[model samples]
Target chain A: MSFVRAEGIFQSYGRRPILERVDVSVKEGEFISIVGASGCGKSTFLRLLLAQERPTRGEIRIAGAPPATEPGLDRGVVFQRYSVFPHLTVRENIVAGESFRTRWGRFGGAARRAALARADETLARIGLDHVAHQYPATLSGGMQQRLAIGQALAARPRILLLDEPFGALDPGTRLTMHDFLSELRTETGMTVFMVTHDLAEGFKLGDRVLVFDKPRWDPTDPDAYGATITYDFDARNGGIPFQTPEETLHALRTPGPDPVA
Target chain B: MRWINRQPGTALRAALVATPFLLLFLAYWIGSEIRLAANPSDRLLPAPGTIAATAERLFTEPDRRSGQILLWHDTLASLLRLTAGVAIAAAVATVAGLAIGLLPHVRAALAGLVAVVSMIPPLAVLPILFIVFGLGELSKVVLIVIGILPFLIRDLSQRVLEIPRETIVKAETLGASSGVIALRVALPQLLPRLIQAVRLSLGPAWLFLIASEAISADQGLGYRIFLVRRFLAMDVILTYVIWITLLAFLMDLALRWLSRRLFPWAEAGL
Candidate 1:
């Protein structure tokens, strides 16, 4: 059985459908990149994987069993912004990631010293050791995002989810982050599912790139039907879709930006 | 238009800030001089010198009847009531605000009720508070709480709600329980905001305290002011009013300083 499976999942808010017939299966250590136009329920799919929300229909299984009802230690996630806790120092944030397993949600005495030592190690790995005592607000955007990623990794989750993790970064910073993420992925051998609007980014870091789009469209009622997986490309072999990305984007109806995502 | 947009130099800006206060004092002095010239013993507009003398006497001399310096006694009493009311309000608002902001059901149940309570004129129920609590310290302190509690809760809850969903989700994905989230995640973020909320509520809290004390109190700044009003002692009244304003201003300054000192990270967004 696949390590992660979502079979015929559907989701809707009130009367409006957002996602439908979203089926996917992943091996234990696959790097699955999800890409689509805005408002195509890419984030909704990520939310389902995180177990932050339940699908209106169907179920998701992890390691041949039902996924946890709530977001759990098994899955770690990073977002484009506001991913790190502002009140905590960078080192304290790393400690927080690990401290979730403690009985009182915090460490004390020797245990805290051990956690702090481990946090320092993680900080050095992320190249944030020098500013570990500083709060997130003082850091530049790229550095804050780096700290966010490092904080998530401290928990040692089995699966790592990245939602447009480098979308807010500058081009220069984005390149460096990509290299950093790739190295970390190789070292940990953890499964990663990243959502991105940048097509090149989707192909570059992903083992398999999954595209989400609406199969059925009603121009008069734009939201009548929801989005689903339209293409699943094997990105490992430099396999590009027959249609260029510009043509593909131009063909789809973008109905403005995705409000919920 | 150019003049309107023109920025003032630091020294010029300081002068501009002082202009209104200087003008007001000049006007008051002129008015008092005119009143005194017309009638040798004018009580309504006492001279600034007379007011200053009265304040000094009130500060240093013990009261003939009670053996307590009336000014200090009244100030201590009023401050005690304000502190008790505000501290309780802060504690309650922090917990209630976090709950309303974090939990969907708590918000659904309490948000509207809190909104309605805030809308109801607090002073309109002054008599009810007095009757229920029976004209004691409790009634006055309770009045301050009722007057500003709703506003504090609303401000704090709104602030909590403003915290990004992404941050909360990030915590959850790291396996933080609800208790852990409340204590480790939400409370630290809310403390600086709680100070801010308390600062904003100070004016209304002071108003409620005075109003309640004016209605029924043995020793308070408001009570003292009302007591001297019967004899038409403008100097005494003016001194107490100035003292009250100074106290409120200092309290606001202290809270602002505390917020800055404790949560330097929060300063960046502001």
Candidate 2:
């Protein structure tokens, strides 16, 4: 059985359909990158997986159970914008990782000390120990994003979702984040689903890549129809080596003759 | 020329701030002098020396009938009413604002009412409050609360609503219940803003307090000022006015200091 499964997922915002009849099955510990054009419902799909919003039709099951109606500790998410609580210092923000396990979102006595120590350790691992006392606002953009990622990881979620998590970072910082994420995934063997605009980022980080698009686009009835998964690529064994972004775009635009066949 | 664009040092900034007050004082002093020169006993604006002596007497001397320092008694009475009114307003506003901001149904029900209530000039309702609560401390406190409560609720609701959707979602994914999110995530952010809202409302709160006191109270700063005005005791009235201004300034400063000390992380964004 798949670790996470979605069958005939359909989503809409009032009269506007955003996703239509999409199906996805993800294995445990697999890294999947979802790539698509803007407004192609990549985020909508991720939201469905996280259960931030319910699918208009069909159901998503995680670990043999239906996904919760709301986001919960089993799923941790990082967005392009830093998600750290601005009112909390770096250390406190990290300690918030244990918010789900602790009673009333608080830790006390030995548990408090353990939580603090774990937060400190995560801070060191993320190379942010020096700024543990600083608030998120005082940190650099790269540092803030890193702190957010670290905070998410500290929660020990079963799956991690990223929505253009490195889109705002500079090229150097973006590369660093990619490496950090890859290492973290390898170390923890956590399932990762990242939605990215950059095709190269998706290819670099994902073992499997899913492309979403409107197969039958109708300009007049844009709201009536929504996107679906157009192409699925097993990126692990593709013969294409080091394609330029333009080449990658070309290959994705016209996925030639179903290589999987 | 050198100082035109450059930021001022601490002493220079202090002097710059002090300059306006000094000029205003000079204007008052010169006006008082000219008025006194024209007439030895000007009742409208007393000389600075007369105001000072009145202040000394008010501060040190006991009242003939009550054997209590009238200034202190009035100040204490006025402050107690102001504190009670503001504290109740803050508490009620925080809870109401959080509910209205977080729950769509509550927001739908109360948002329009809040807007309409806020638009109604609070002073216009003073008579109603007096009639309802009676001409006691309750009425006075209710006046201040009614005057500021709607504004506080509106400002705080807007503040709570302005909390980024991402933060709430993140808190939810972190396994925090709705109650936990409200108490921990939302409440902490709202507190600093509550202090700020109170600081902004202080002027209005004081206005309502004084108006209520002047209309009915036997002993209060505003009551004393209004009473002395009938006798043309300009020195006593001016002294009370200055004292009121000083007290208001101190209260604002104290609230600001408390906000900064308690929530240092809040100002980090600034």
Candidate 3:
């Protein structure tokens, strides 16, 4: 079985089908990005992975556990909004993962040492060690997002679910976070499943990108907004390279905000 | 910026705005004092000089005194009732907040009833409680509790509910059980708001103590106010009113100090 697998996943909200037998698979330690326009069931798919929502007619297995029940420590998730607790300090937020685990009478000293070590190391990676004791409100938006990333990474989960974690940042800060995530993923080999609307962000970070669209909603009209998987391929692994043909790139760059991808 | 609000010298602006009211208030006090002096009767409104002497005799002379005087007796009685009521209300309301906030169906079923109960003015319940518990501390304490518990529970429940969904999800995804998430994630977010709620509850409680003691009790500021009221002694009433307002002001400031000490980040302006 794949490390993270969704076999023919289908989701419907009140008789309106959003995902119709959508299937996507991420191997161990692989980086998969889902890119689509707004309302294409990207967040719904992440919710399915996070076990916040169950698919209407399919199964998602995370390291041999069903996503519907028994949420394991193997999956960590970060979102675009309110990911960090406003009242908690950075160090406190990072160590939240360890607070929930059972050490069986042995976790106090050694487990503490290990969680601290992980927190310190992740703080360094996220470049937020200077403000480790500061609350989230004191930090900038970029820093808060990085702190959220730090908390998610602290537990060293097998797979990470990132739903537009950087979608709300300025272009410069978004680039910086992208660089941090790329390097962190490379070194730690934490499998990442990301959802983003920015084409360039998806292109630069995705080992493979899944494009989705919702068919326009109409009972009789067949295109009635049923979430359909548009493009699914290993863009970097054996799948055809999506070469934009430099001429087209050069033509696009000549004007109009420099064609993002 | 609004014309009145955004000005260079805030102190000057505030003083300018307050000057008229302060003058009127001072004028009234002076007018009352002048009226008392002209009357030459201590029973009506004691002259400022005589009232000062009365206040000094009533308060400062008893500086060495410890257990019960007007100042000590009223203060101690009010504080004791306030503390017991606040403690019981906070403890019970916090539990109710958690149970009602965390459980959706539970809140939906009970919220309407809580709303109904909270609407009936708390002072109205005193007569009923007095009949049941007798005109004693229990009646006053239970009255304060009934007055404050509904608000404490309602405010805390809403604030607890307002905690972002992501924080809970983050904890659960990392293997936190329901209890752990509630204690760690939920409680911390709820605390600052709860402190403000407690302060709101305290204001009415201080009012209730004086109101409850007005006709029934033999001691307390309300009793003092009542004693002076028999002779149209407005000076004593005014003195007691100032004293009670000051006490409330000090209590509120103390609560704020405690909040700042415990949660320093909240105090630092962004």
Give the top-scoring candidate (lDDT): 1
Off by over 4 Å in 3: A70-72, A103-110, A216-224, A237-261, B1-11, B17-21, B42-50, B62-68, B268-270
Fnat, one value per model: 0.76, 0.55, 0.61
Give per-residue CA lDDT, model 3, range A1-261, as digits (tens). 478889889898887778887877778887888888777888888888887888888899877774656445777888898887676788878887566654321136777788777787778878989998888889888999988887877666788999899988999999888888888887888889899998767767887888888655666764455686788766562344556566876887777555432
Q: For model 1, how does the per-residue alpha-carbon lDDT over A33-148 read when each residue is reduced to its tens digit?
A: 99999999999999999898999998988887666788888889998899999999989999999997666789999999999999999999999999999999889888998898
Best-to-worst DockQ order = 1, 2, 3
Backbone clashes in model 2, listed as residue pairs = none
Q: State the fnat of model 1.
A: 0.76
How accurate locally, in lDDT, is each candidate? Answer: 0.90, 0.88, 0.78
Candidate 2: list runs displaced more than 4 Å: A101-103, A220-224, A237-261, B1-19
lDDT of 2 by residue, B9-45 (tens): 9999999999999999999999999999999977888
Chain B fold agreement for model 2, TM-score: 0.95
lDDT of 2 by residue, A1-261 (tens): 589899999898998889998998999988899999999999999999889999999899889886689898998988878488888889988998786445588787898899999999999988999999988888878898889888888888888889888888899988988898878787889999999999988888898899999887778776668999998887753425345366555685685653322
Off by over 4 Å in 1: A240-261
For model 3, residues B131-213, the per-residue Cα lDDT tens digits are 99998888888887898899999999998888778877887776777677677677766777777888888888877777777
The digit string of per-residue lDDT tens for model 1 on B17-52 reads: 999999999999999999999997989999999999
Give the range where candidate 2 chain B is weakest over 10 consecutive residues by summed lDDT.
B261-270
Model 1's CAPRI class is medium
